[model samples]
Target: LKFVCLANDGIDEHMVWLIGLKNIFARQLPNMPKEYIVRLVMDRSHKSVMVIRRNQVVGGITYRPYVSQKFGEIAFCAITADEQVKGYGTRLMNHLKQHARDVDGLTHFLTYADNNAVGYFIKQDLVAVWRINGSVAMFRQQWMLRTFALRRNSQAESKNVS
Candidate 1:
């Protein structure tokens, strides 16, 4: 359940993790163009959060933070075939949201989910705005904002109690 942020320093330090993420994305998202995935995942402007279990990557999410716009565009998200339906996707996304909120100060998130992933995004509280070019728009809801604050406060409280 550990989430690791693969740094894009153009160095060899995080090469293995990046490769693992790329492989997972390739395996899970077959319809997506491989060239697109490779370019964005390796792009310096994008950042990824990988789910690491027992020193192996199980899932990951790639996103580009638009700091000036106060939003982050989620480029790709996936879990390995065997790992789906185990709630890893939810955790991975929550981790990514936290990273965006804390690190980049992003207030919203945007993603273009294909039909296959529409349900997943809906479950995560994202709504479809319009259906142009088959890209479903997912936005941050006001309730999610309040819920995130409450959850964070409770976690802090539990830590204080401990």
Candidate 2:
């Protein structure tokens, strides 16, 4: 599979990739709102990296970079259900890290992982960076050190939101 980085531009291929990514997220994250997914994925401030194989989009990640903060917030990451457990997720995350560092000048990544996704994030080597008073579990991976940390509130539940 090849990774296609895309933005919410007027380009035709990018528009197609965005639609495919939206479909993947809709199918993979059944609990999340489709409208919410569409809004974020199509937002100009957010960018996506789609995993394309055989000219079809199989998976992707949507992120927003905070250059001033030296980090990028991962809003949504999903591989098609059929494509799961095939190392695509790992490779996708690696690509995002490279793009964040080299292109976006980011040093860290921040993402909120729900219970169902906690394991996946951990396996990606992203641990809990910190715990807020709220119920969300924020996972962070330091690019330079390649370390992960996790602090979470198990009592609280949330949709797969950023």
Candidate 3:
């Protein structure tokens, strides 16, 4: 399971990979929404990671980085249907984490993952921090200090004392 991941900020030269991924998703995973293809290929703000194995796209991810929040949220991520459980997802995730930490100085990462992806996120140490719409699981990697939460707790304690 050797993976080659290429990072692209703007979406000019990676259209081929994007198109290939679209075809794979359409053919294999027909249930997957087509909106994700638009967001990944048409959007310029997303950071796209293309995972190539044997010169084809085995997986890909499109993530949005928020500098203010100091964490990047995974807009979308997936591996090929047949490629699942081969550790390719983990490799792609590590690539994104390295990009966030080394380039953006982000210590946290978040993603709205599906119920089936819960185990994968957990393996990456991203806790099921919350749930959205009582469906999608909001997973978070909290590697940085939570000063805001600490302060809020302290303030509440002081109020109780008074």
Which model, 1 or 2, shows the larger lDDT? 2
Report, for all candidates in order, the number of backbone clashes: 0, 4, 0
Candidate 2, residues 74-129: lDDT per residue as tens digits?
87889999889999998998788778778988876666554566667766656544
RMSD for each model, in Å, please? 9.6, 7.3, 9.2
Model 1, range 1-162, lDDT digits (tens) per residue? 588776577666477788889899988877667878898899999999999988788989998888998877788889999989999998888888788888888876656555566667656654333222322322221111111121232221101000
lDDT winner, 2 or 3: 2
Off by over 4 Å in 3: 1-13, 24-32, 128-162
lDDT of 3: 0.57
Q: Assess every candidate by TM-score.
A: 0.76, 0.80, 0.66
Highest-scoring model, lDDT: 2
lDDT of each: 0.70, 0.73, 0.57
